[model samples]
Target: MTNKHSETSFFITAEEAADQLGVSRATLYAYVSRGLLRAHPTDSDSRRNCYARDDVVDLAGKRRRGRKPVDIAKSTLDWGMPVLESAITLIRDGQLYYRTNNAVALSERASLEDVACLLWDLPQADELEITPSVLPDGWHLLKAHYAKVPIIEALLPLFAIASEDGQTGIWQCDEARLASGAATLLGALFACITGCCPDRHPLHVQLATAWGQGPVGADLVRQALVLCADHELNASSFTARCVASTEASLRMAIIGGLAALSGGRHGGMTERIETAWQAIDPDNMTAHIRRQLAAGVEFPGFGHPLYPQGDARAKALLGSILPDFRFADEIVETMRALTGKAPSIDFALVAMRRYLGLPEGAAFCVFALGRSVGWIAHALEQRRQGQLIRPRAVYVGPDPGSSA
Candidate 1:
């Protein structure tokens, strides 16, 4: 997202520029046909237009005098196009891209109109309010829910007793504990499951005792737990702050956060991941790797940008509870052999889901549930802080002194 290389002047489209001017697309096209608008197209498609800052300002200045705009033949202008497209992008990289959410690279010009159409799409979030909370809040501090537990609470758990199972061993993904002991948050979660499961495997009973689950059910619960965990700074967070800033109820913020988590991205990744997993076959992992790579697709299970050494979360989950799952090893080894990388949380989660007999479509639910514990904790924290977060962006537009 760095724009250090971008010059002040750049390329933009008639459609995008038109929107900025509060003009209709048809009107902009008319201007383009006239000599008044300078259109820079990278290829045959005029939709791939780029505008020079100087040229746009110049045109804007010309329009200010109330002179009728002129039209020039499409053939009249022909100097540089790809160069123009390379400039004038909101989000710039080595080269300018349209920043469309479509799977295809925005490198090649996508439709300007379609890109603009998404302007209205908004995410929903849950609302939460807390009179006060002892935990930290927000997307960044999701893991803080566990690793950052209070000392008094930790001691209370050890001395406290549960109704049926004796102890509700709440394992934590604390970095220190992970390094010398259970190894990861994911591992900790799995151990908790095994600790709690009624039909825990003899070998896994120890793990269940530490974690806890049931053979007949808990898939939905687990998935909900993960999904509810953390959804990137979303609707709920927004609504919560909106309420808090106005000094509203804590309960409202929790509801806001809930609504946001249900949005297309957060609740949906599990489904997306499931679709990806189904498209890939763990049985023919080698073939699957080659096929996906040949097709120029990223293999589903490996490599996370955040975790360079492999996702510690994934490693902790796979390494601890399902320690003997060979498919996990196969995936890591084959991916390394094919692409020179390790597996990530998604991959590890998929493998876990696959082994647990959770349908591909349902894998994300597990993630959702895992995330919920953290989400509730964070919401509580945000409610506790009693501060509304509102980030601002730099205004890079026409100045009052400028002619246009």
Candidate 2:
């Protein structure tokens, strides 16, 4: 064990800290800005800084852990056992929090625009007003390319155009520009999805009008949008962060999110559940489910690992509908009996879309739209961190000298 003198000698001067870490003064300052280091001001000269011994040792240990192959290569992409830190969102116990507010509770009062501004730390505005004049001119091409494709698929080309919109040199771009760009991208995508309404209303209003629903329908749209706005470090949000770590444009980063959301086990799970629900004969729900099970088919929307009791988003959304819709009530009852689990967000979205008379595949469209706000929020945050997210992999292929 070390003596008391050695224990008190742990704190070091700025030059000593720099030499010990083997990093330049500028890099050291950058670390401080990134919240990776803490510096204390000296009594005689405030300009001269002293770093805590434990903090420096922790940073050094993190650097070593990052370099070690076994630490990097332990795959936990499904539930992310490897904790990737972000200030964007947090899930505590069973509730989800976005920064300082409870997400499910926030959805009870806030609009999707309010949630977006809150997540981006913009000025407190009740709504995000995006003007139509900033709309990209490539809608003609987008219409041609995605004429026969699902609206979710069209997001790829739509974002590609938005990414090249006069925003140059990403590293120097400011927060206002990023936020405005996100608003425009969201507004334009909504226009494309809903068959191009000319009214420049708020996002929920535009969607409500496009689907020909009045106040009741608009309320559902708002609730779903708020609930789906963000989930902490989910697959798509992580993809957005990864792209932004490379200093990619916000649009490109959101496009990365869209690509990940299209995967079968992520957003595509909603599509599968929608298909299953459509096939159900509500009058004879039990017989229908039994037939499906006898045929070795498993229903997709009944359970979520994160919400064992039930998804709060699903409960809030489904609660609003089950009281009114007879068929939806039957579907829920049958699913619960078969699996002993409650419906998830995917199930709620599909049921809500059907209740509103939206066309098939509209559930995925809503999910993608609502989640785009989260993607942009994450991208902006990742940009501020200024760190590349390249996790290393352990090599297990043939040796360098071995022949194929």
Judged by lDDT, which candidate is best? 2
Alpha carbon lDDT at 380, candidate 1 = 37
Writing each residue's lDDT as its tens digit, candidate 1 over 93-163 gives 11112222321232023221122222211121121111111121231233334234422122112111111
Q: Model 2: per-residue lDDT, tens digit, 77-128? A: 4353333556667654456678758888887877888888888865323356
Give each model's whole-structure lDDT. Answer: 0.39, 0.75
Candidate 2: misplaced stretches above 4 Å?
1-68, 123-127, 136-138, 162-164, 168-172, 197-200, 399-404
Task: Mark the 10 consecutive residues where model 1 has the least summed lDDT.
Answer: 80-89
Task: State how far residue 254 of model 1 sits from its true place (Å).
Answer: 4.3
Per-model TM-score on C-alpha atoms: 0.39, 0.77
lDDT of 2: 0.75
